[model samples]
Target: MENKAINSAYQYAFIGAGNMAQAMMAGLIRQGLAPARIIASTKTVASSEKLTASFGVKAVQDNSLCLDADTIILAVKPQVLKAVLNEIDRQKLQEKLVITVIAGIPAAFYYDLIGSRLRLVRLMPNTPSLIEAGMTGAFAGENCSADDRETAKTLLQGIGQCLWVQTEQGIDYVNAISGSGPAYFYYFIQCIAKKGEALGLSYEDAETLAIQTALGTSQLCLEQSDGNPERLQSLIDQVTSKGGTTIEAIDSFKRNNLSAIVDEAIQACYDRALAIGETYTK
Candidate 1:
């Protein structure tokens, strides 16, 4: 944990004091960003008070106070983001750098809402962000300057790995992949544990085995990987014998068109993200 501060000059305002905001604020503070430079504004006084007490940052119930901050981060849910935006006076935001983490919303949508150009960044971060091991995909609006992108990266890096893409559509793809990926892994782990229990193992023992195996495999991949996809596949191949049980399982997956099924699932998720954006835009 490096204690070096990032862009310490700018004042940061988070519009929602929920788990995602708390996770990001915790990471920033852990990395030595001054708490006094940040403020969180929740819809309720009680929620604002609780966040202030927990994080030692300024908290307010009024969303308009965000206008005074140098950077504004919209952390509200997608369903309510429009209401929050409508509440704000757009004239006050003309010069502000706005970053949004509301899932499925596009930078273009925000641009249309404001009816003017300003620095905006649309980001998609996953559940893993709570542990500071998250992957965030970001896309800066066309009018955003290089410095604006760098600022967005610096803050996002405090919490996890960050990537900037050339196109806004890239963030939608990220929403389908990394954004929903943890749930897929969890479901797979659940299925494995259930099968183990069917084989006479106690539920707890089966879960332990399933989770440990998943964890061990991830660790092994991390150790052997040089940032190459082929390296991971090679490691998997090493443990799969030509006619062993591992091969049997591989064959079964292939017979069931597992790859196609997974691809379709990801495509469906991506389609939904696009649809959500359209819904908000309308």
Candidate 2:
């Protein structure tokens, strides 16, 4: 569906102005959203002042002040989300389109805390959003209109790509893959760099090689395979010729059950996300 242009007069207010919120704020501004149309609330007066100075946005110490915005972004930590929700004037939020980047909380939890009238969109965006190369997973609540979903997608697109899922549970899967996935890749890079160091390469040189190779390989696969699993496997096979060193490494990884290890890790992440949601709802 073609996205409706976001009204320039629409005001966006972020409940928390931390790293992710700041990244989003920067992205929006870079995408031509005026700084005057954006507001942020920080925990302290000093931080609020810092944000206002740095981003040229309206910053406040009071969360209630954010209610005036047309779109409200809940960017707080999951642990503190309930407390924050409790403190806000829920009635004021009934008409506003709310988008949450907080993990592990479902729309039902918010409906209970605020009201059933709330319109919400849940997003799971990774750290790469700081660099305008992030992948975001989104889910619109039953209360949200099509325009609400489109607005959320448009806002997220400023930072990177946005993908909408069919159910809220899909957000948990997204969290496991794209959200927690960055650290997994970072860990793999570290492992490669460490092994290269042990093989007598300087740590800096090894890290550079590992990072560049990962970047190049990801770009190649994205361009050539379009994320088709069969094509991706074919790309891997291209480098894994019989009797080659690459095949030796591939055989060792397969013998070590690398795929299973990754599967288990993702399952653990998804389970933890469900547990957190359960904890909050209960």
Candidate 3:
């Protein structure tokens, strides 16, 4: 096994071949990591074969590859995490750093299950990661060294932007924001399209309009200098003409307490993530 502290070129492994795992793998592969340097595995040969075909990396049906790599990413769902962890004996990856993207699952929970002090990281990735514009939030474990964090950051950097958080509980907030955020956007788009249709817009036109509007607005926010968060209030002030349509919409949203709605949505996601880990423990 390569020393995770030192930057060995050939030291990456993924213990699950799921969606986010595949997204990260694609990001790493695109960022110039040799496919041969990374290995991935799942519970079955069929899954492994699919990953091998997709990424041209080593894929196996065993967990031993995880223990052998300098970095191991545990990508299984929270409910199946312990079984996945138990399937692989810890002595293999105990010294090797591990990164987990399971929702609502904390590293300390894994330590309690594995019964050891291991270097671990909790990662929360949004669904947009598939398109390479993801917002990923990460929090390090107690035992993770600076090198371990760099390994995690290096692995995630190419996928999108990364936010380093201070605590595992912070991952819950991440879950609410980055992890479950894309779905919320999609849901809003769907509702907007539905309303457009009800207002007599053709179905296809309404759908296209809703999708493009969201996309264009996002691009505007990203590309415009006016999108600065610190100047957000000033930006809004500039946008609102006296008694304008935008102000009417803003007043409607404020009357409905949109901020509170957004907060509750995020908190709900956080609560659910914690609940997922609780389900695993039971």
Candidate 4:
């Protein structure tokens, strides 16, 4: 299971061809990765047929068939991951680079299930990946070589932005922020729309307004920040002028301890991620 030399051109196999798996597959194909080099093993024949029809990739219901590829992507659910791993050929798995997008599982958990020599990378990618605008966090196992990291980065970048964290626990921090982060924004948008509805605007009009505002605001922050945190704060300050309507809303948020509430929510998410990992360890 020790790190071995891998070919620059990889043949990838996905264990479960779900939404996230399909996203990655789409990105890879869009970036010129040959669909013939990709294989997906889904849970059902219908799912397999759907993938083949949509992506022109080979698809099957047999998990064992995936081991023929040099790189394996574990895109299955956390609950079913153990079963999937158990069903795969362990010896073959040891020689391949395995990248897992299943959340709340540590690299050690995989090593324990497979072998310590297994080359593994744990990844957390958000839903935006479907549209190739994902934010992904990656952590490599100790046994992985520099090539393994690069291979992962190359494949991931096709989908969107990729960040490599130094520690495995950093993956949990990622889970708190970007992993569960999309739902938080959606909830905020929903709340805004609901408020507008209460204020006499139609639900459709209110939701459209909120959605556009959110999209424009995100674009503004990204363009203006230029990777500077302080610049982002400055952007916020620019809109919250003294006694302005924006300031009124900002004051109400502050008065209600919105910052602390968000902090608690993120912490809760982080804790739950760690707890899930702990469960697997035990």
Models 1 onward score TM values of: 0.94, 0.97, 0.89, 0.95
Per-residue lDDT tens digits for candidate 4, residues 79-138, read: 988998898788889889999999998888889888889999999999998888999999
Clash pairs for candidate 3: 104-273
Overlapping backbone residue pairs in candidate 2 total 0
For candidate 3, give the lDDT of residue 152.
87
Instruction: Tell me which of candidates 2 and 4 scores higher on lDDT.
Output: 2
What is the per-residue lDDT of model 1 for residues 1-282, given as tens digits with 9 covering 90 to 100?
Answer: 342358667789999878878988988787777888898998887887788788889999889988889889999887888788898898778689998888987776787777567789988998889999888999988888988887787778767888787898999888888989999999999999999999999989999999999989887886898888898789979989997989999889999999999999999999998888888777
Question: Which has the better TM-score: candidate 1, or candidate 3?
Answer: 1
Order of quality (lDDT): 2, 4, 1, 3
**Best model number under TM-score:** 2
**lDDT, residue 23, candidate 1:** 87
lDDT of each: 0.86, 0.91, 0.80, 0.89
Candidate 1 differs from the real structure by a C-alpha RMSD in angstroms, to one decimal, of 2.0
Q: Which runs of model 1 end up more than 4 angstroms from their true locations?
A: 1-5, 226-229
lDDT (Cα, tens digit) per residue for candidate 3, span 38-132? 88887888888888888899998878766777888888766677677777776666777888887776666778766577888888888888888
Q: In terms of TM-score, which candidate is stronger, 1 or 4? A: 4
Model 3 misplacement above 4 A:
1-8, 223-230, 278-282
Q: What are the per-residue Cα lDDT tens digits for candidate 2 across 124-178?
A: 9999999999999999999999888777877887778888899999999999999
Cα error, residue 109 of model 2, in Å, equals: 0.6
Better of 1 and 2 by TM-score: 2
Clashes of each: 0, 0, 1, 1
